[model samples]
Target: MENILHSPINNNTLSDFISAKDYTVSGNEFSIKIDEQTGLLITTPRPKAEDLGKYYESDDYISHTDGNKSLFEKIYNWIRNYSLKKKLALVESKHPKGALLDIGCGTGAFLSVCKQAGWKVKGVEPGAKASALAKEKVQESIYPSLFDAELNGQKFDVITMWHVLEHMPDLNATIERLKELLTPTGVLIIAVPNYNSYDALHYGKYWAAYDVPRHLYHFSQQSVKQLFGNHEFELKETKPMIFDSFYVSLLSEQNKCGRKKWFSAFLMGLESNIKAQQTGEYSSLIYILNRK
Candidate 1:
C-alpha cells in the first residue's frame, strides 16, 4: 500500500533467483531477482502499486476473508488465536506494554488481543474491507495508511509489521516513516518469511511463502538486517514462528502436486524445523529492533 519501487538497484546489482507463478492472484509467472548487494529478492516486472489492489480482490486471498469453507482455512483460524497470544508474549518479553502501532493489520485480530491485555493499540490497514472489520474490534482510529494516521508528533512505544514489509513498494521510505513514528526508546518488531530457511529450498518455487508480486521482496536474515541496518535500526533478537513451516508446507504441497500431499508436506515441515535447529534459520522469523 506504499507508493512503491523507486528501486536503487542497477543491472549489475541484480541476478536471477527464481521464476514463480502468482498462485494467489493473476496466475501469471513472475521472475524473482536477487539484489546481490543486499541479498533481497525482487520480483521482476513488479506490478505498479496503484494496480496492486485488484490482485488482492479475490475470495482466495485468505487474509481478507475469514472463510472456513476449506480445510486449509479452518486450520488457519484454529491456530490463529493461539499464535496471537504467542506473538503478544514475545513482544511483552522484549518491551514494556504501552502504545502500539500495527502496520497492515489485517482484520485487527492481533490488535484486538493486545487491547484486551490493556495496551493502547492502533492499526493501519489499506484494505477497506479489512480496515472496516478491524474497526469493530479496535476502538482507536484505523487509518488507511500511516500518512493518514496523523500521530501529531506523538510516538508509539512499540510498532509491529507481521508479514507486511515484503509487500511494501518503497522500502526505505517506509523505514524512515517508522523511525519518525517510534519513540526514541521504542521497539520495532517485524515478522517475515525467510528465503534462506530449509523449507524454501525444499519447496523451491512451490514455496507458498514466495507469494509473488504481493511479496515483491523476499528476505533472508542477512537481508533483513541490512535493510534496517542501513536505516539506523538496531537488531535486538530473532524468534521463530514454528507453526509457519507446517502451514506454508501445506499449501506448498498443493501447489507442487495440484493436490494436497498431506503426508509429504508434513515430512517437509518437520524436516525444515529439524534443519533450522542447526542453522538458526526458521521458516519464518520475528526480528526485534530499536532505534540505533
Candidate 2:
C-alpha cells in the first residue's frame, strides 16, 4: 500500500491563499494538486499546521456561525444541529453512559448534548475561542491539541472525529493514536465527505467538500475502508449524514454559480440523495469502526 502511486486529479487553490510577499500564488505555492489512486484524492504536500491556522482565525472556523446569524441562518443551523444530535443520540444508544472523547470538537455543541445524556465527555479543540466557549458547556477543560490531551493512559469508550480526519496531516499516526486511546470495546466514529458522491461529480473542482488546503484528503468509501483496515481497524457500520447533501449542495452552488441558488441547490441535493440511496454513496458518511 505504501508503494501505491497517485495520479494527478486536479489542481486547487486555497480560495484565499494570497499574501503581500507573493502577489502571484502558483499551483505549487498555496495551491494543492489533488491526486487519486484507489479512490483516494490525496492533497500533495499536506499544508503545515501553522499555514493552516491562519485560515481558521475567524469565527467562521466552524462553518457559517460567525456572528448574529440571520433568521434564515438560525433556522438552517437548528436543522443542522438537530440532525447532528440525532446522530449522536444513535451513538449514545449503543454505548450508554460511557466515557466519550470528541476530537476537534468545535464549540462543544455535541459535548453539551452528551453531557446532558449522562456521558462522561471530554473534548480536544485547537481553537482558543472555541475551546473557551466549549469549556462553558463542559466542566472538563478542553485540551488545545490532541497531544496536549495526554490520553495515553486514559481509555475512552467512544471516540469521535466529525469531519476532522480529512484535515489530519499524518493519517497513519492519527489512526494509531486513536486506537491507543480507545478501550478494548470502544467504538470510533469518523465522518467525512465522499469525493465519489454525485454532488462531487457535479461540482468538480468547485465541490465544497474538496475544500483544498484545509481538507487535505478526499476519501471515498473504498479508500476509507482500506486506510482503516491497514491500521488494524474494521468497519462496523456506516450511516449517512442526510442533511449534509443539502448543505454541501448549497455551498457548491455558491462556488459554481457565484451566487445563492437555493432552489437549484435543493433540487440537486434531492437528486444526489436519491442517487446515493441506490448506490450507498453519500455526500457525507459516518463510519463506525473498532479494533480488528
Candidate 3:
C-alpha cells in the first residue's frame, strides 16, 4: 500500500522561513523525494491529513474571505479572475459548453464564472469554510471531500483539478477515479508546479510551491507527462501559467532570503519566463489530457 517513490528534496513550511502573520506559523521540517526515472518528487513519510489540521483554514486562505477586500487584494483577485477566464476560454475551445466538474473548487470562483458562461457546473471542495463559501456562490452542492459517494456514478465532459493533483498522496487511485468520472470524450485538466523550472532551481529547496508535507508531490513536466502516460492519458496540450513565475518567485524570495525583494523577485520571474519560453519548462504548467 506504499505510494511513495525514491530521491529527496528538503523543504520547510512557508511560515518556517517567511515572516507571514496571515498563515499558521508552523516551521515543521520535511523532505520531498524524487523518482528519477519518473521525475516525481514525493514528500517522504507523508504527514497525516489530520496532523496537518486546519492549515487550509488559516487567514492566508483568502479564497474564503467574505465582503469587501483591500485595494491590493482586489487587484490580486482581478488578476486571478482574468487568468481564470483565459484558462476557461481554452477549456471551452476544446469542449464547448458541456457538463464541467471542478475539483478543489475553492470558494467556487471558477465555478460561478463557468455557470455564468452557460456551462453546467459542479464543484468539490474539501475545506469546510471554502465549501460553505462556494455553496453560497453556486447553485449546485459543493461536496466536502473527493471521496464522497455522491460523485461515484456522475460523469462530466470536463474534470479539472487545478493545482490539486500534487496535494494527493494516492496517485494511482486518484488517476483511476478521474478516468472513471470522465465521459467517453472528456478532458482532464491538471495544473501543477514544475520543479524543473528555472525559478525552482533558483530557489532550490526554498521554492514556495514545495509547501512541504501538504504538497506531497512536486511534478516536473516530464514527471507529469510520465504519470499520466502511465495511466493511459494522452497529453493533448501543455499551457503555461505566466503569472505563476512572478507569484512563486516572490514567495520563494521571501522564503529563501527572509525578505521581500520585489525587484529581485520580478527579475528572477522575468528570467524564469524567458527560460521557459525558450525551453517550454514553465514554472507552472496546465496539462490538457485525454484518455489514450
RMSD of each: 2.4, 5.8, 4.9
The sequence of per-residue lDDT tens digits that candidate 2 reaches over residues 1-292 is 0111243222222222111111112223223333334466666554466677764544434432324466546756688579768867878766767899999887788888888878898999887777888888687868877766466688899999989998887777788889888988899999999877898788776777776566777788877887899888999899998888888888777777777688988988899999999998889999999888
| Index of the highest-TM-score prediction | 1
Residue-by-residue lDDT tens digits, candidate 3, 134-173: 9889879798777789988999999999888987767777
lDDT of 2 at 27: 28
| Pairwise lDDT winner, candidates 1 and 3 | 1
For candidate 2, what is the TM-score? 0.86
Score each candidate by Cα lDDT. 0.86, 0.74, 0.78
Candidate 1, lDDT over the whole model: 0.86
For candidate 1, write residues 135-199 as lDDT tens digits. Answer: 98787778888777476586899999999998888788899899999999999999999988998
How does candidate 1 fare on TM-score?
Answer: 0.94
Pick by TM-score: 2 or 3, better one: 3
Ranking by lDDT: 1, 3, 2
Q: Candidates ranked by TM-score, best first?
A: 1, 3, 2
Stretch of 10 with least lDDT, candidate 1: 1-10
Model 2 stretches with alpha carbons more than 4 Å out: 1-37, 62-68
